[model samples]
Target: MKVCYLISAVSSDNTGRGGHYESLKILAESIYENGLDVEIVSLGDIFPPTFGNTSVKVRFIQFKKSDSLIQYIKKVADEIYDISPNVIHSFDNKSYFFARLANVKIKCKLVLTKPGGPNPKLFFPRCNDLIVFSQENFAFFKSRSRYKDVNVHYLPNRAKKILCDDLRIREIKELYDISGKVILRIARICDSYKESFIQLINLVNGLNDQGFSCTAVIIGFIQDQHVYDEIIALDCKYLRVVTEERYTKNASALIDLCDYFLGTGRGVFEAALLNKLVFTTISSSRYPVIIDEDNIDELQHNNFSPRSILKNRTEASSKEFLSSVIQILSDEIKLNEKRKYILSVAKQRFDISSVMDSYMEIYLNCFPFKRNLIFDIILNSLVVLKVYALLKLSKNKKAKA
Candidate 1:
């Protein structure tokens, strides 16, 4: 089936961590791999690298970000009329809101993928189906009865494959000047959350007080000018901030040396895939999270209370950061076991193949008009198995030869 995928922006040159361009890339590639007709329409200067390389068509309808809903819809409608797709999948709430507002009787099946946000319980104009990163959030949304007839579905946020080539692990070790046992935090320097930064600073102070000799490497961009200032003030040797090119290479490299990732982060699953420990709290329902935490440090409210910008996180105050840090430090085997569990779970549920199946099922459900017979399903399944076997054998033969 031919599908039209629309997103906010896919700028490879300036892909902020918050932007879901990588996820969009994976989805687009999978659609083409499955032998489906696909066209991508997005705002901004971003173009898919393989746009002309693939059979799938990629089109750009350049529109300003500030365009109002009516104006935006008119712009999209003009193009939609020209290249009618079987379905239109909107990437996030902003794009979904605009698309739904634009298309009332929605000629094509409308689908949306929600990848969590600073604002939880986002109120968006209804679509055919709501694809969430968490089943828990989906159930919560379903219970609220926002849209009576709309379908809500859950799919795990798939891990990204960094375009990193093999390098001597030791080269990375010396480049970061890392000690192999360092702690890593790969969050963007600038973020939309005040609590996220506040909590991180508290955690660092907590870890230091306990005399944990672990280093912290700050990967990703510094979005906030003030936060950048705060980080500079620390002047901590172990915790250094690097930007752009260094940031990209260091991430793939740091994955090897880091024993654990400890932050409220966007890179937990990425860490898990690279075989590192990821530790963070289960964010309050107020915040959106896609990747389920293997261990959640329940928030201790009183401990977070402060009269001013500097908060007091003492044991007497409810034991928020200190207790969880201590608990994590005390249990080495626990973190190791959690790492093992993450790898096992990822291999089963969040791999590219399984994630592609989730998208296909959603596609089939959203557009029942396109019917494939039972025989078609059987034939496709057999072909998939044959392809898998041939690839496996090719690898085996190459190793032997």
Candidate 2:
């Protein structure tokens, strides 16, 4: 069966960055490998660097970010009409709404890949299936009355082993003149993940005070300008900021250059595959946990917290966290042993082929619809009319005032 994938933005550039784009790339590759027809549509620029001469049809449709819902529906509906896919899948709320609007006209099964915690407000009754990145998210969604019968599956975020070399790592290190220990953190710098970023800053500053040479390489798309500004204001010599597009093409190689890895979510999975020392701060967790074989399963199943943001971690916890990091960095033999175990776990669980198998099962199970054209038309028309009426009422009130 043919499938069309829709996302708000493919990447900071066409090649792509971030978990959503990476996840989409893997799933699309699986679809292609299985000999299924797949098409990708992005609201923003779409020439993904990762797709790299693949057969998937990737299209970019330009639209104003401020466009109204009706405008968005029309634009996405036009594209969906052309693709005529059996199933339309989306990755975010806006795209999910776009898929629903398009489905009204074409009767395609709508699937949402929920990468974070459940948002009841974004729930749509017409969605056929949902794939979540963590068990916590799956259970949360499953418990919702609105999603009582919806097919919700817990699929831990997966990352295929990435090839990287020490030579390339050194080249990057030399390029930046990072002479001391290289600590890397890849995440979207924003308020929601304030604890991680703040902790990274504090950890680096604290280490430097103890005469330890260390540099924190912060990478990822900047989601909030204020947060970005705060990071810049730190003016910590050990801090080096890099954009998502700069190293995403060879992300593993970049991670290889690091003496230690930080951040949470999919990057943690990638780091483990690369056998880097992974210490992460999740929203749900009180402090950073260094990933090891014993806790990897629980960490993978729970993933990162979606909504909670620690205002600030406690001083005692901060001191304990710093001690753990220093201890790890000081022990070369123990670090190597941990690396071997982490790599083995990654191979066993995060293989893309297995991830693809689960995805394929979901796709095959969702049958194509024999749509009631009249009912769809009536329902969608009523929705549009209700919105229009509300707008008109507000305009009349403004005019009278």
Candidate 3:
């Protein structure tokens, strides 16, 4: 069976860095390797080089600013019809919207993989199947009355073992002048993470003040220029921010070089697969929780994010969190044990091979193609208006601030 993967380059910037792109790349490559026909349909200017040397076909349908939404949808629908895929899987909400509307012309099974957190202003389109990465999201969707007839799959973000070249690792270390114990953070440098970035800098300073030689390296795409500038302006000798425009090396390679990983979402699993001690925190978290034998199950349930656990668990304060990390770093035996356990758990839970198998099953299962053109048009109109209003409100609030 042929599968066409839909990605929205406009929404994601086609930067080749975010979790959605990474996950799609891994899944698509695996599907192609399994001898099934796979094609990636990008609705923007150009696809990122994340595909690397893979032979999978990538078709770019550039959406011009002058084109109306309906025109773009028709254009995409024509392309998908030409590909004649049995299953069209979309990664982002925008792509899913287009695919849902386009499917009216071409009646094919549709799948949507919800990548980010829930949006209050947006509404999900009905599809043959839906996949969510976090357990909290999966449970919430599964219990929803609207999705009683939909097939909701709970699949966590996956990471495969990546082998980093020794030469490349040495070059990255020399370029960053990394020394002593390294705490690495990989995320998008946006307004949501501004407070977390500041907290991380302070934590590094505290670690050094406590007589531990430590350096913190942050590698990420710069989404908000103001936030990125604010983070860069902070005077911290122990901190280094590697913007995406500057660093082009594989992120997993950096994880392999780090002694501890500091961040949340898919990066937690990526770092764990590399045997790095993973510490997870949400955007609003004052302190991070270390993932070890005792808390791995709980954390994994929430996709290693403390957002769901904050209400029930009393988290450590800034000082207490730093002390805990320092204590772990100082004890070699404890740190080694934690690393081994994390690696084992990562292999068992996030192995890409198993994830691929699950996806294959979903793709092969036949699901009826159903659509209500009138209801869909009304639903899409309301969703677009709500999104527009939300954006306007956000801009007003930012201007007032």
Candidate 4:
């Protein structure tokens, strides 16, 4: 079985580092381990130019973003024709559209992993399979009249378990000079999650003022210059901001250095796996509290969607939420066993290895077959030229206008 991924560049201020690229790399490797072939067609210009480093041997095609939409679609289709992959999986809508066009004659299984939003536009009828991270998203898809027969899978995201020795964890702590209660919140310096970096600083400041010796470790890549500047301006002594390049690369190590997690989405799961008390500010029934057995299912089914959870509860302020966080952290001694229970659930559910079988089954059932290579090459070349001409004509029209 051969699968080709049509993904865009990881350069957007929002949703770029939301594990779209990282998860693809992990999934591709897992697929390869099951004795299938995998390839990638990365769209746009990925800055820092240092993504997708993996051991899985697959052909990597860099699709330049400078081209017009017609040109871009043509290039994708041409690559699909040349590769003749049995399955074309896309991570976003634009790529899915182009992949559908590319597979017009090819008739391959098209899969779409929905983008970061509640109401993602599901337009391609050719998409045989759809993957969503939450029940809410699944419900949204089901409500769409166009996809009554489409197969939509509500598969929650998974993460590799973080492994570190006690010595290593201690070293990380010492590097940051973290001696007191360590609180970690991992997110990009963006406004997508209704998260305020300024608010976090205030929370840390509040904790210190209340005679609690604690350090707030804010670790994430800086996507917005304005937000980054605002965070830096505060310079709260208790807040240690680690705005390093590719901070997600070192997320596990950083998670190990914290006593509590004060974030949403994947970071909360990672902290739970590491046996730390986790409190999410995201939308869910258990918002602003430690994730326990009683509320794990709701959060899990909801995919820990931060922004959505916060939207309904407009009355919930960060200052009010911080008080609950303070109360939880202050009573850490009494909640030690609850912390262990949270880790147990996280390990059982969120580990990538545990969930690989479902993915493997999906790939295996895609019904792989070969297409006429000679005819595809001939047709694709003609289509490419046609698109190029249309692109030129469009440009001319725009210039004349």
Candidate 5:
């Protein structure tokens, strides 16, 4: 069986935090082990030099963001035409949207997962199955994930266990000499939306003043060196920003090393998977402050989204948000109370052992025939399309009359 992953860029060069890479890493390893052919195709979004170091087999298709919707759709279809896989699993909105629009003529299965914030507008008319991370997210669009119409799987997003041997982790621990009650924000500096970085800074600073004495480690690709330099230039010595590369190895290690894990974008999912204590901030534009790329990325998902317009994420009461942050970090019992549920939920919903079984079941259902009966069905289906076309002509005439 040939299965392909359509995701954001998978450049062997990048060694940073990316949902596409992490999930696919686990999948490819499992699928390849099962003796199935696997390939991952990049959708040409994101900064260059993605982690190509993984064992997951990969390829890239140069898709431009500037292209018109029609052009983009055609290009997506064209790319799939060339890949010719029996099953395609697409990640995030753009890949998922365009893959459905491409809708190439093939007896293949299509499965999609929401990579970040759930944007309901991106849903296509038809796909074999859907996977969503949050039940709250699925509830917002219950019609789309009804389990009967589509094999909607409430498979919570999961990362393969971080290798623990990453070089950057070693580097961060040695370089920072990090110790005692550390809070972490490890996400892409260029995610589709943006914000919460500076509030996160202020929030952390506020907690420190409350006698919590916690340090925050910020990690992601600083696309601009001057901006990065300016962030480090801040008077708040507790807030530290590191390169995208170090964020994964070093920062994720720091998350493993730290007392509390702060959620920004999908990074919360990572921390949750690792059994770290995590908190996702309520969006509060109510307490206005300077929001930058990293913050905005977390808030807006940084501009890679098909629909980045998000007021719900940014418009939260910062003071209340700050209070919650302090309470969770300062109160051990309260923190663990939340952690017990999250860890329990993660193991139950995102566990990897049964994923391969799920995929195989979906494939068989979407394209049911493995023999020449499929050919007979196709011949009959073609005749049905022809008969439908003729019936459409008759219906149009009757309407005109």
Candidate 6:
């Protein structure tokens, strides 16, 4: 059966920055290698780097600035109709929305994979199958009455073991002036993570001030320039911020140069595959929790994200946070044991071959089913209205403040 993977964009560049983009590339490549006819339909411009090296064909749906939402979706629908794919699988909310509206005309099997934590503002369109990367997300959707009839599957993110040339590693270290005990983070520089970034910079500087040799290197795309500027303005000597333009290659290689990783999602799992100790924190968290054998299962349930612990989150003093980290860092035997256990878990949980098999099973079973177009559209419209109301309320509160 032909599969059309739909996405908002192919990549920011050849070396993709975000988790969903990377995961799409990996999954698409695997599907192509299995000899199934696989094609990618992108709503945004496809960068040359991402498609140049791949065998799978990519179609870009150009959007005119003057076009209304209906017109844009019609363009997407027309493209899918021409392709006549057996299944149209979309990633991200925007693409999923367009896929749902477009499929009303085409009536093909639709599949959506939630790339991140559930967003209250976004609606999950009724589809043949819905896949979530974390167990927490699975439970969240399953408990919702709206999703009771939908098939929800919990599939952990997958990562291939990364290997880098020694020369490249040495060159990167020298270029960044990285030395001492390195703390690395790979995530988007956005408002949601602004506080966490500040706390991390201060934590690293505190370690250095206390005579501990340490430095932190944060690498990611600049989604929020204001947040990125704030982080840069801090000017901490112990911290280095690498934007997307500078660090374009597979970031997992950088994990090899670090003693610890402070981030979440696929990066955490990738670091674990590399046997690097991983630590994560919730939004506004004063302390970061190390993902060790004791809490690996819990963290994995939330996709190794800060959201996993958000509900029970309590702020600790900076001193307390530093003390806990220092204790863990000082214990070499325990750190080594933790690394070994996390590596074993990563191998068992995130093997790409096994993940591909699961995906294939889902795709094969996703047969065309009857859907109530009018009811689904009305329900989705209500969800959108609710999100708008919430946003307006938030804006009013901010204005009052």
Which candidate has the top score in TM-score? 3
Candidate 5 Cα misplacement greater than 4 A, ranges:
8-17, 33-35, 45-51, 62-84, 92-106, 122-125, 144-151, 165-167, 173-177, 190-194, 223-234, 244-254, 264-266, 285-341, 367-401
| Residue ranges of candidate 6 with Cα displaced over 4 Å | 9-17, 45-55, 66-71, 101-107, 119-122, 165-171, 248-250, 310-324, 378-401
What would the TM-scores of all predictions be?
A: 0.66, 0.78, 0.87, 0.77, 0.64, 0.83
What lDDT tens digits, residue by residue, belong to model 6 across residues 31-100?
8888788988776433423444456888878543344445666787888888888788887655676677
List, residue by residue over 178-227, the lDDT tens digit for candidate 4: 78777778777776643545545666787777666788877777777787
lDDT by residue (1-401, candidate 2, tens digit) is 88888876533322234567777766786777888899888764344454453457887765443455467568768988999998887875556656776776788777788765445453233456888887777777788875665688777777766666677566667666777678888766667667788767777887777656789887666667899888889798888877645554546556777878884777776787877877776555444556776566566655744333334434356566667667767888888877777777767776666777777778778644324334544554554445434544555576789
Predicted candidate 3 versus true structure: per-residue lDDT over 1-401, tens digit per residue: 89999986653233445677778877888899888899988775345556543568888887554455567667888898899888889887667776776776777788888875653235666666888888777887788777777798988888777665567556668988987788888777886566667767877888888778889888877878998888878879999888654354456556766788886767777788878888776546655667777667666666765353644566666667678787888999988988888888888888777777789889888484666546755776565444434444555576789
lDDT of 1: 0.54
Ranking by TM-score: 3, 6, 2, 4, 1, 5
The per-model lDDT (C-alpha) reads 0.54, 0.68, 0.73, 0.64, 0.56, 0.72
Off by over 4 Å in 1: 10-19, 44-60, 64-75, 78-83, 97-106, 118-122, 160-176, 191-212, 245-254, 263-266, 281-335, 367-401
Q: What RMSD, rounded to one decimal, does every model reach?
A: 14.3, 6.1, 4.4, 6.4, 12.0, 5.8
Clashing pairs in model 3, backbone N/Cα/C closer than 3 A: none
Candidate 4 stretches greater than 4 Å from native: 10-16, 47-50, 58-60, 65-68, 121-126, 164-177, 194-199, 246-253, 283-287, 308-333, 366-401
lDDT, residue 49, candidate 6: 36
What is residue 348's positional error in candidate 4, in angstroms?
A: 2.9
Model 1: per-residue Cα lDDT over 1-401, one tens digit each: 87877765423223324425455656777777888888777643344332333345667765443454346557767776666667778775545543443454446677887664322443344555877665445656677664555688767556554444346335545666766356655555663443444444455555666666666656656657688787768666556455555444335434555676643422555666766665543332211111234223121111111111112222233244455555655588866666777666556655566777778878877842212233433443343334334444555576789
The whole-model C-alpha lDDT of candidate 4 against the native structure comes to: 0.64
Total colliding residue pairs, candidate 4: 1
